[model samples]
Target: MKKITFLLVVFLALFSCQKTDSEETNPLLNAVLYMQQSAEYKALTLQIYNNAAIHLERALADKNWTAATEQNGDYQNLPPAVILDVDETVLDNSAYEAQLINSGRSYTSESFAAWCKEARAGIVPGALKFCTAARKKGVTIFYVTNRGNAQKEDTRKNLRRLGFPLEKEIETILPRTDSSDKGKRRAEIAKRFRILLLIGDNAGDCFSGFTHASQVKRDSLVRVYQSHWGSKWIILPNPSYGDWESALFDYNYKLPQSEKLKIKRSRLVE
Candidate 1:
């Protein structure tokens, strides 16, 4: 009887330990883990949007200016427009991130689509205000996102529900159809309007060669466009996930979570 009781106690203790470890084993935790939970993130987002507002005014005054480096000088006479990434740039999907963390699940398209269908995403700190100001200035707002075209209606519903300005007769939201690289989409918009500024959390949103580039190549490309960082290309903070994380893993998505984590830790400078 004593031996039986001892074995039961050992089992209970082991179960308790396993439960605790499982609860704490989320690999998504990092310095930016509390970004949505912290005040600093809000402030930084506000600052970036405010700066964008100021730059937009300046760009409007200079009809000859085009934020898109790929755009030729002839496009200066076209109507003004701003290209923005929907996720993490204009929309606060931190709730989705929180859900992933709480559920101990990595991001999946189905889950993200379900979240979009719910349309519960809130506006980023100053996104609405900046976008509103840009619209009032008669500048068209183009949302060029990598979200699959299958999610188009839900994404539109979410953006419209959040009171984002959308074009009346023309579709301004461009979703991923064939490629993840947005250079072609940007060019398509550039042909119609003079792009004033490009805003996003990922470098790929603002420039080419950043989509699947290595860490070294990405850094080199950033340096190559050193002058465009703050002026024409406004980047929001998104440390949770992006091409930045993908670069750490050599853009290989097939790696197991454990291997990806190992690779990430190995790449850390500290």
Candidate 2:
């Protein structure tokens, strides 16, 4: 009888511990974790929109082609447009990676492409409403992502699912092709857009040649664009991956995993 009672207590303690453990850990954890769990975080989209809207308004009022130009020109309130990076900028696909991590699966283009086709990715905080409001203000919002061009139709569908009201005919979609570098696409975007404001998660998406450049070149390039850092270039937060990570290893995607880790370790200050 005592043994049975002891076992029962042990089982209860184990159950309590398991419940607490589950409460402490989540399979889907990322910047959007709060949004998925809380309504308050979900509404942050509006705040993001408002902040960006204010930036654009201020830029226009100040007449800045480069996010508040010098001397405030007559074109202060001229028609405005924004360039947005797609992956991680407007869509939160980290959940798919989370799903893979939780399931002990590796990332593959085939699997990722399959996941991309789901079109279930939630919007990045504030991206949807910001773009929506910008659209209302007659600002053309264009998405410029490094996603392969094959995913174009699916990407558009995903954006539409999130209520983006895409300018499908306005030529805003800019997915990556075999020939696209970060700058190549930006140059393409430049041809059609004044591109008053630019937004994205990755440095490559935001700065052309930034990812594939030497470290010294990276710093120099950033300095050249330093003036526009926060004003015209509103970078979204992302820790998972970016061109920065690639540049750390000299942009050699063909390097073995062990060599990459060695390179990262050598560069570590600590």
Candidate 3:
């Protein structure tokens, strides 16, 4: 019995040591993971959306105001609308992100489609209140997302299930088709509605130039539009994933994991 007890202790100690080593060697401590798992992230999201609600009220009353820089002649004559990005903005997809981390896998279209088919995404904090307020004020809500059209049905179902205002014709949900850049789609929407505000987690959602910009270019663009940020564009916190990550490695999706990790580490200021 003593011999068996001694062996069991040895096994447990070895297993614990291996587990700690694995964690220390793993380089998947992404910002998205931290953002998704932290209570502070939830609080910040709620704060941003609550602030958006306040700004939405102000934007609606300002007839001369327009959020879309693409808006051209006679834009003020059109109905008021707000352009919003779907993922990580209005809808929370941290579960899908978490699944990738927990499973020790990267994001794949097949997995993403499977996750969307479940239609289980939850509404972001204060999103319902902000959208509901906009709806009540007769403002149109247009969701422009990079999610392909193949996921449109599931996306719509998920949004509707969460009590979001959805048009019966489903014209409001615009998914990516030929390109991921949303500037063209925003232009199309600008032709009809006077976009009051643009809300998203990515800088690309607001400006096409930021779509594939380098880290330095992105910083420059942000400086250029510094004034428009809080007034016309409400950006949510999405440290989990976005163009920012892609910019780190120069948007090279094919790079090996180790190479990407090296580049990411090299860019650190500290």
Candidate 3 off by > 4 Å:
1-18, 24-37
Write the number of the candidate with greater lDDT, choosing between 1 and 2.
Answer: 1
Residue-pair clashes, model 3 = 1
- In Å, residue 196's CA in model 1 sits off its true spot by 0.5
Candidate 3, after superposition: displacement of residue 43 in Å? 2.0
Q: Assess each prediction's global lDDT (C-alpha) against the native.
A: 0.89, 0.70, 0.87
lDDT of 1 by residue, 42-105 (tens): 9999999999998998899998888886788588689999999999999888888888888878
lDDT (Cα, tens digit) per residue for candidate 2, span 1-270? 999999999999999999767544432344335545566654554565566777887765554474322213354444566888887778988788677646655456888889888878878777877788778877887787777877888998999878885774677788877655656666655555456777876656666656577887877988888866667877766555667667788778788756876887798796
lDDT of 3 by residue, 1-270 (tens): 999999999999999999877655455445655666778888887888788778777877888888887888987679899899999898998888877766778888999999999999988887888888898898889999999999999999999999998887549999997999999999999998999989999999888889999999999999999998877888888876789989999999999878988998898896
Model 3, residue 238: C-alpha shift (Å) = 1.0
Off by over 4 Å in 2: 1-50, 62-64, 67-79
lDDT, residue 112, candidate 1: 93
Per-prediction TM-score: 0.93, 0.74, 0.91
Residue 43 deviation, candidate 2, in Å? 10
